[model samples]
Target: MSQSLLIFAKILSPITSYLNPNTKPPTIAKRYKGKATLKLDIPQGVADLLLKGVINTDTRTYECIVEIIGDEDGSQSDTAKLVVLVAPSTPVCKIAGVAEYGQNINLTCLSEEGTPSPAYKWQSHDVNNVPRPNPPKTTDKNGILSLYNISKDTSGFYICTSTNEIRSAKCFIILAVMQPPMNKVSTCVILAAVAAVIIFGIIIFFYCCRKKNKPEEYEMGRSDEAGGKQLFCCHGIISSSRCAVTPTNNV
Candidate 1:
């Protein structure tokens, strides 16, 4: 009689769990660790989620088993999907005005659209070019960035990152400060005053020109030789000689 050799194989179902409470749960990959051997005792739904690209791991307790499926040759396959979670979605910042030395600055971050709440952090290009003081500002609860009364030393590029095991987003904020001797508000006022003075001078010049062009007037009076007789007109209509003889004494 010849001896017989046999191989034993076990088939297991997939892992299906709710990754997010509000959104549809993601599907896990079918093969984990590039293995084709299926485990026994996998649930029907869980087996499907595993094939879709999800890794089963109890984040809170880490009790879930990781299953890997391989091909006929037993070579590892690339069908499993694992997601890393980081928070705050679409983080960005804007400058209210020119960031100047010793000026109070405001920086805000928003992450309302992310699956999981994101977080904020401030960074600068250090002398050695290293990212230091990671997580300059963060909240353990929610994602909201608020920086009030900022100073010149705080001027630099900031990064806002959002991740939740499935998807991620990033944004950068550049802070620049300018300290000039001239104040912006005072410069505007000075320019306005100079303009007003120039306008007033122009108005006075036009008014004087109008006054000089006015017509002059002269009053007509009787000549002394006519003895109260009317003065002679240029056309001789009222000549002194044409007066009545009552002025004969003058003649």
Candidate 2:
């Protein structure tokens, strides 16, 4: 009849462990004649083998093996799969083109590093920090928001939220749709028009004054006894007042 002995081994070290020949050997004597003994000062439970931390470049799994030399059961081993959890980071946002009326633009959000790839959600708000009644037309996909032929109504604050199973993060940007400048009447043109009108008025006023101050001429009829003579005078009418000078002519 063969005797069977059960040996229990507890791995109590940092990340990795291995047997050292110079300090201690892991093999048992073939004939069971030699005494094989292991002293464990600090008892550590198996649950402590499962390592957990934030996911980064140095995350990996570790394995522990328990071996018995004379046991009917061969070598027995167990592996601990270490998994690191990472929360979502603040999303980076970018605008593709100028925010102007009648122009097409795109807003993009990105969460570069996360344990689980993050999803994106887009929202808009007005200048007063209130949600708009009717949001602009957009295509929400992956992490991009597209606006076609944007208008003044599309100008506002855009919020981009990135979410994962672990956590969520958000970022915001302002979309300002610029309006084309209005055409204004020039001051130079107005002043030129006013000056032209004044010059025309002055010309008309001088013409009227010249016509009013010019001298007047009159022709007077002579009596029959004066042998049918005609008279011309200046500065007075023939019948009203005496003339300063008179010119007589025969009919």
Candidate 3:
């Protein structure tokens, strides 16, 4: 039994060593071209293998495959294709809000993401049944739609269509016409005119009453100033000279 165990131990030690040889670590091979460059890293132990011809870095303008070697029979390999895209992304269009009548309404369409700069087209329709004949006019360099001097006729549905070479999107806003506040202003003017007329009539009536009572008031004042009140007498003076006076108890 001791001899059998010794033989088994010796056989397992060689098998383990044979299975675990000096293995090369995995690596990444990259190829770059133009203004853009591709970078790759191989582990320290396997980096020497990449420096050798084991890893192919020789393709037109930097293309290669990483070949991994180990104690195993077959060497595994991987291909790395590196593409550099420097173009910008496409922008998105959105309708922020709409403006009402008699207001400076602003409609905004913005790109959430993009590079080559998206373009904007603004179209509007009115209730008059006629389509907006003209093409959408660009409002800003940054794609902002400013509807200035809004009026009743200016109220309508506005559409902002944004497009890029790859994709396109549209957004819209419905602008309502706000009726000018007529009742308040008209009622105020009317009330003011009515009050003015009422005030004028009151003043004129008092002035006329005062004028009508002026003669009677003046006569009463003069009579009060005279101090001597007299009664009406129809007889004239009977005797100018001194008259004899008679006092009699029986006559």
- Top TM-score hit: 2
TM per model? 0.31, 0.48, 0.38
User: What are the lDDT figures for the candidates, one per model?
Assistant: 0.45, 0.64, 0.45
Q: Rank the candidates by TM-score, best first.
A: 2, 3, 1
Between prediction 1 and prediction 2, the one with superior lDDT is 2
Model 3: pairs clashing at backbone N, Cα or C within 3 Å: 88-115, 89-114, 89-115
lDDT, model 2, position 187? 62
lDDT for model 3, on a 0 to 1 scale? 0.45
Best-to-worst ranking by lDDT:
2, 3, 1
Tens digit of per-residue lDDT, candidate 3, span 1-251: 01100000111121011111224322222321121222223233221112222122232132222323332434333333322222223334444444444455567776664334567777778866356742233254356776665667776677777666656667766667676578967999999999999999999999888777653221111122354543221222332233343454666
Q: How many residue pairs clash in each candidate?
A: 31, 0, 3
Estimate the Cα RMSD of every predicted model relative to the unseen true structure.
16.8, 17.3, 20.5
lDDT of 1: 0.45
Candidate 1 structure quality by residue, lDDT tens digits, 1-251: 12111112222344332221223323434543343222333233232222223223311221243323332333221233333344445655554454665444455556555433444444444333455453344232233444444455565676656566556666667665556457776898899999999999999999888767745422344676647666653322555543332322434
Candidate 2 has a TM-score of 0.48
Best by lDDT: 2
